[model samples]
Target chain A: MRSINAADITEAVANLFKQANYNLGADVLAALKKARKTEESPAGRDALDAILENTRIPAKENIPLCQDCGTAVVFLEVGQAVLIVKGDVSKAVNDGVQQAYKEGYLRKSMVIHPFSTRTNTGDNTPAVIHTTIVPGNKVKITVLPKGGGAENMAKLGMLLPVAGRQGVIDFVVKAVEQAWSNPCPPVIVGVGIGGTAEKAMEMAKHALIRKVGQPSPDKENAALEKDILHKVNNLGIGPMGYGGRITAFAVHVETFPAHITALPVAVNLQCHSARHRETVI
Target chain B: MIKGIILPLTEKDIKSLKTGDNVLLSGTLYVARDAAHRKMIDALDRGEPLPFDIKGQTIYYMGPSPAPPGKVIGAAGPTTSVRMDAYTPKLLAKGLKGMIGKGVRSPEVKDAVKKYKAVYFAAVGGAGALISKTIIKSKVVAYPDLGPEAVLRLEVKDFPATVINDIFGGDLYIEGKKKYSLAQ
Candidate 1:
């Protein structure tokens, strides 16, 4: 069995959070550059220019890309042959998040008793962790910091099995229309098809980690992604709703088999600040 | 080409502004978001004075990240304006003249803008770092317990924004969408 120290995991996660927030992903930057040329509205083009320029300041100044550094979301893929040494994975992950938010000066966005007192957690901790046991010996860790504006706009629909593809397209397009500029526009639409309700929601969020313009391997799913992107851009939400053709950078769809009679679909909209990073150890 | 605007926007200034006009706003504005808005409303309900005078003042719907060493403030940009809708009309009634934020506002907010002779401005969302460059000064004014959500007094120089709603019932989001929307 391959043994991995929990300290290493903690360090990796902390660095990932810092790097993800400071540096806008190259793919997202490229998409924005492309959008700047294609956006028809004068206001829309100006917004894109500001957004593209914003990408540079954070990296050069060693500051976060956005004020809303977001909730720490850690995804873990642990191989069956690997054994964690010295500490539990959950504690390590939380420690990493705390260290990163505190030392890196990222915003502490998490709050406890969310419905009631709504107290700030002081340090962004108790990361929302999703773990899966995989086949290899190495552990793959991915940090995805989800901002509240876009996350609050996430929607789920448990459609009738017969609702079919058109139903999904309509549902997703309508959701984006309703969300409008609230999700910050020029968003990445993540669609999770099939699976149970929660599973679909999780999958929807997971789909956002894919690089901009990357399509799903499944032919039908990829086609749906393309079609959804077209319909969404046609809504003319544009960059921050200044209004033009580029409402979304990409639409990513992930699917799994569902129980008969269950056609669960979830849409997780990602803001223009698509911050995420991954590491394998 | 952008118009330059000074803060403490007057009735004449509000009347001159229209939706879709890009402006470089300079001078003083207070920053507050969800938590601070709630507290301010509660203070109003108690017949208590707000920490800052509301008359002819503009409130920026933003919550800044903690500044790193040598910076006046961290990434300072506008938050979603709709979240402040619940408390806005009440604030507007108290003589608040302008608001800077991103995204669309509710019908009630638009109506309040017209009724109060106020204006709503939209900043580029997600451009926090760039926006921070415009903020020359910042300090917490109230509710220090709210951390990032605390109310802050800020001085800005040519902070970029677009007029989204105006005193004459103009709405940029509606006009922009109508201009580009292809669907019937």
Candidate 2:
């Protein structure tokens, strides 16, 4: 069995958080550039240009791209054959989050409670972490800084089995249309179908980790993504709601089998910043 | 397009602005999001003085990511404005004149804007990195315990943003969508 120190994981994840916040991923940058070229409205075109320019300036100067440095969401793929030495994995993750937020000067946006006594945690700790046991000895950690705008726009619906494919498509398109300029388009649409309510939401968020505009390996899912993209862009919400051809940069779909009588769908919309970083150790 | 102008802006300056106009902002603006808004509103409800003077000041709804080494701020883009609607009327009453953020405001906030003659502006939401260039300096002005949600005083220059809602009830989001809405 391969042994990995918890300290190493903590440090790596900390760096990932800082790096993700500092740099706009290449895929996201490319999409913004593409949007700038095809955007019809002069205002929309200009919005895209500013977005692209923001990416360049931040990277060169090592600054944040937006003020809503989102909640720290960590995804862990732990190898069953590997042992985490010297400390609790979860605490390590939180420690990493604390250090990164403090040292990096990132905004601490997370509050201790959702509804009651909404108090700031100060160091952005106790990250929302999800772990999966995988086949390899290597551990992979992904940190996605999820902002409130797009996260608030997320939705889930449990449908009857009869709802099927058409229902799924309608639901996703409607969600995006309802979101309009709220999620800060152009957005990356993540659709999770067939799982239970919470599971569906998880799947939708995980789906966003895929590179923007890349097709799913599943042909049926890929086709659904394309159709949803076409319909959402047709809504004409455009860039910053200024009107243009590119409202959504990509649509991603992930699915799992559900109960015999249930068909569930969840939509997770992410704004163009799409701040995420990953490391394998 | 209104050319770049520096901040510590006066009511006279932002008052002259209209919906759909492009402006490059300079000077100092305060950063406050939900947490800070709540505190400010609570203080007002208790008839206590505010942490900072609101007259002629612009508040940005953003909680930026952490900056890397040798940087003043991290990807600092605007957050949705609607979330702060509840507390806005109170702030408006205190002589606030302008706001910088993305997304729409509530009807109550809109009414406050109309009643108070304040303007709401839209900064590209996801363009954090680019916006930081305009922020030449930043310091926590209040609620330091609130961390990133703490109210911050920021000095900016040539910060790009467009007016989304003017004091006349004109909304750029509504008009822009109408101009671009595709036929069903």
Candidate 3:
């Protein structure tokens, strides 16, 4: 078995959090530039300009892209052939996040209790970690700094298998319509199809890390993305939902086989920042 | 046209505003988000004084990151406003004259804007870096245990925003959508 030091994971995750906070993804920046050119509303155009300029701040001066440094979400793709050494992988990851948020001046958004005391965890620890075992010996880590505002608007539904293409299309469109500016448009829509309820929700969120403008690998799924994109943008939710022609910058769909009777659907809304970064070790 | 506005907006100032008005706001401002709003309401219930007076004042929904040394505040921008909808009407009734944030408001909150002759402004969401440049100074006014969610009294100059809701019930989101909507 290939042994990997958990310290490497910790250090990598720490740096990822620091970078992802202020560094707007290049793909997201490109999409916004294109949107700014084609956006119909004058107000929407101005909003787009402000957004584009905000992305430049980190390069000139070190400041987060937005104040809500978001909940640290880490996805681990671990190879079955590997063994973690020196420490636990999960603890390493949390330790990395804690150091990064504290030192990098990122906001510590995690609360100790959901309902009661609601105390700050201070270090933004206990990252929402999703782990999967794959074939290779390498560990791939992806950090998505997911803002609470957009996350709160994510929706999941378990349809009776009868709620086919049209059902999904209607549901996603309505979710975007209802979420409106709250997710901070022009938003990116991530659709998870054909998985169990929780898996679908996870897939939907995972879809956001995909590069903008790239369609799903499946021909049929790509078409679904296009259809959803068209409908969502046509909702006139525009940039920052101030109303324009570009409510959604892109729609990505990830699909997996589900039980015969289940047509689980989940829509994950990502705000304009769409901050995420990945590294394989 | 981009209009310059001074803070502590009164009913007269709000009545003069309309939805979609581009404003460059200057003067004193307070920042609070979900946790701070909840705490403020709890303080109200306990009959304790608010950190700052509510009359003719404006609140911005945000919890900024820690400043990166030598700055008055860190990247600061509007958070989703509707999260504070529950506490907004109560605050408005007590003379909270204006609010600055992003996102759609609940119907009740919008109604409160009209009833109280208050105005709701939308700062550019995701433009925290640019927005923070406008903040001249900031300090924790209350609930320090809340950390970033604590109530912060901020002094700002020429902060850019758009009037999204006005005293006359003008709603920019609805109107903008209706105007550009393909189906319409």
After superposing all C-alphas onto the true structure, candidate 2 shows an RMSD in angstroms of: 2.3
- What is the descending TM-score order? 1, 3, 2
Best by TM-score: 1
* Residue range A1-281, candidate 2, lDDT tens digits: 99999999889989998888778788988888888888888888988888777777654565666667788999999999999999999999999999888877677887788899778887877799999999989999999989889999999999888988899889998998888788989999999998799999999999989999999999999999998998888887889876677889999999999999899999999988888999899
lDDT of 3 by residue, B70-128 (tens): 88888899999988999999999999988999999999999999998899999999899
Q: Kindly list the per-residue Cα lDDT of model 1 for residues A1-281, writing each as its tens digit.
A: 99999999999999999999999788988998998888899989999999888998996785788999998999999999999999999999999999999888888988889888888999988799999999999999999999989999999999998999999999999999999888888999999999999999999999999998799999999999999999999998888998889899999999999999899999999999899999999
What DockQ results do all the predictions give, each relative to the true complex?
Answer: 0.80, 0.62, 0.77
Instruction: Give the alpha carbon lDDT tens digit for every residue of A7-41 in model 3.
Output: 99999999999999879878998999999999989
Q: Which regions of candidate 1 deviate over 4 angstroms?
A: none
> Which parts of model 3 have CA positions greater than 4 angstroms off?
none
Comparing 2 with 3 on TM-score, the higher-scoring candidate is 3
Candidate 3 colliding pairs: A185-A240
* Selected candidate, larger DockQ, 2 vs 3: 3
